[model samples]
Target: NNFIPFYFFVDVYHEGLQYYVIRSIGGNLILLLPVGLLFPLLFKKLNNVKRILLTGFFISLFIELAQLSISVYIRSVYRSFDVDDLILNTLGTVIGYWLFFILSMFYKRVTYRFKSNTSINIE
Candidate 1:
């Protein structure tokens, strides 16, 4: 139950690719998207995509290693540690960085418009 590297995909070989997307890739990506989004928001220096991706990758790796350690020390196969998770998590961070950039751009435009429109006229 814990050491399934390709469990999501190989477990259901006849189930088509949908299983991989729904169970593995999509889930991993979604789980980490928030990390990507929040990191940039909290740390302005993480605005770069490369930096975010690297950070996300390291974070995912750390999680996987921790899971492995727990599984090895406490219980056998307690958590599934997969390499795919690292890739997906890093991708999620990149996506999150882009989302933040887009949202910030929109926010700036809106604010600029509102400020210009709200001018105080003193005759």
Candidate 2:
């Protein structure tokens, strides 16, 4: 909490565009994708969009806060806590949820078709 928070997109605006894209934006998104995909799978209650999104937001917020804590208390600047990272991480989770939903639908359809074909009629 003692760490200074950047309210604006200073990192992306002032830093190298390529670095921001590759490390900050894309990295955070990719890093949190598994959290999004697995949360609903592991916990049925999170299958809903609102719950999943909230969980994602809290998880990212926790990570950012933890990073800030380490920097402030432990005297380490291993990471930078930024709100943009939080937003991007949440978006990544949403994308993963959609990916899981699409894959699940495809799996259900294929299994249903297979069962329909294999089941025998007791005529």
Candidate 3:
């Protein structure tokens, strides 16, 4: 159980373990990117940034706690809980939310232009 944020990062860097840093940090960040992108699209209530942040945080926290519980139950270190994972995962979610926001805005603008340019008259 590692509660210190970015603590593993410092140790890995000192040891010159670039691969570990990339795999750990990058993997965690990418792991939740889909959650951020899909949650807002699937649930209209999660369209705002604040809602996305909270959802991401709670989800990451649950995963960490679950890992801790599983490790304790198995009497082995199945996975260590790290605060940095929560931070990176939440950041990934926010990044995904922004990407979704930009895509939605672009879609709206394009569709509006298309609608405005063509008209059907009926009598």
Candidate 4:
């Protein structure tokens, strides 16, 4: 009997995995946009892994808090204010980050192969 507001844009009863999919891609990018825009000037010296993981954790916390608070405003109050969302969203972000790493690795390898095959100096 969990309550989700009308304006949440996505259906809640579809299962928790729906939220994971939405948050994993759209939410991660939404949350990362500011960090990506700001990182060059704000914290150029920080390591990428630590920055992504730590900020992603905070972003997940923020999402959970937003959901909790907004649901309160609707006064339906049926959703459980559980910590599990925080865990799942943050892990989703981490998974997205890993996906980025894997794609980049493949891109580099493919580009190297293409460049070598064509006798083009990529350096």
Task: Identify the leading candidate in terms of TM-score.
Answer: 3
lDDT of each: 0.80, 0.79, 0.91, 0.57
Q: Higher TM-score: candidate 1 or 3?
A: 3
Model 2: per-residue Cα lDDT over 1-123, one tens digit each: 223333344555566565655666678788788877888889999997788888889999999988888888978786767777788889899888888888889999999999999998898
Residue 83 CA displacement from its true place in model 4, Å: 0.8
Q: Is candidate 1 or candidate 4 better by TM-score?
A: 1
Which scores greater on lDDT, model 1 or model 3? Answer: 3
Provide the TM-score for each candidate, comma-separated.
0.83, 0.82, 0.94, 0.54
Worst 10 residues of 3 by lDDT: 27-36
For candidate 4, the C-alpha RMSD (Å) to the true structure equals 8.0
Per-residue lDDT for 1-123 in model 1, tens only? 334555556556556666555677787888778777888889888888888888898999899898888998986888868877877787887888888889889999999999999999999
Q: Sort by lDDT, best first.
A: 3, 1, 2, 4
Q: Model 1, poorest ten-residue lDDT window?
A: 1-10
**Can you write out model 3's per-residue Cα lDDT over 39-78, one digit (the tens) per residue?**
9989999999999989999999999999999999999999
Clashes of each: 0, 0, 0, 0
- Residue 114 lDDT, candidate 3, scale 0-100: 98
Better structure of 1 and 4 per lDDT: 1
In model 3, the clashing pairs are: none
